[model samples]
Target: MVKIVALVGTNSENSTNRQLLQYMKAHFANQAELELLEINHLPLFDKPADKKVPEVVRQMALTIESADGVVISTPEYDHAIPAALLNALNWLSYGIYPFVDKPVMIIGASYGTLGSSRAQAHLRQVLDAPELKARIMPSSEFLLSHSLQAFDENNELIDQDMVAQLEGLFEDFLVFMQITSQLGHAHSVNQKLAESVSWENR
Candidate 1:
């Protein structure tokens, strides 16, 4: 089975973003092994002088590095991704290159109508940074609007159309993973370049 790391992009206990990931985990259990990673416990990124990362953060990086792909479920805060998620990404990129050339799938949930469109766009830009270089799926997006009513008592998506959309995107992701795995001729170079990014020169 394909191994996927799903990042829960919020610190809130009642986050619908997390709920959306949970639903994906269960729904895709047969096709992929989805592990939900929480960004809530990561300490605020401080750009430490020693350049030593927390063991927990390192472990998180290791897990992400070994995954076939990543799924990030984000929520908009001030029309952008939450600070917690951004902080986690900061940690993941500092002196580490887990995201370099890694395949990524972006998803989002929101209570409002825009369905975190701005945040998803912002996330794509962030992931494309030289230090990250994640290969986000093209022409694909899964947005769950009015997320409070998107699920049911069984923790499954309530709307058939929404479920169908998710299923199609997920299938596309599986194919994308395979395609990206073969597009790794420059993977090592990308990782090295990402590691060599110098903040002191900036």
Candidate 2:
């Protein structure tokens, strides 16, 4: 089954970003398996003590490594991505390099009128690490303003137009990920063949 890990960066139990992510997951239904990555459990990064990585951090990396793609749902905090999200990204920067060439998409939701626009922009910059290639959506795709009031407790989107737009965005993202996965598989097979040929020559 195709798997996509949805990362929610807020620790709040009633976070609107989490609700938005749940709505996105609903769009996939049986087409893809969705796993939610909780960022609250990760400890802060410290290079000196990096020899022993936290279990939560390691689990997060493994999840990202196994997934076909990632969808990050974040809320604005002082005009920037939440520290929890940044911390999670830092932990993933270890040897695993889970985000390397991974198909990733970012969505932000907030109660503010701009809907976490500043935070989204800041995140786009941080995700520009050499190991990661992020496919950030345009400003129009940012869900904000009445995000908290837009969805019910069940995480079902109440706005018809918003639901339609989100569906279209997810459809396009899935197609893009499929193409990328095909190319990655081909590359891996070619590399394995090259290794075998080298051993035969030896």
Candidate that would win on TM-score: 1
Could you tell me the lDDT of residue 124 within candidate 1? 98
Put down candidate 1 lDDT per residue, 176-195, tens digits, no spaces: 99999999998888988997
Number of colliding residue pairs in model 1? 0
Off by over 4 Å in 1: none
Give the residue spans of candidate 2 off by over 4 A. Answer: 131-140, 183-202
In order, the Cα lDDT scores of the candidates are 0.94, 0.72
> How high is each candidate's TM-score?
0.98, 0.83
Clashing pairs in 2: none
Give the Å error, residue 39, model 1: 0.7
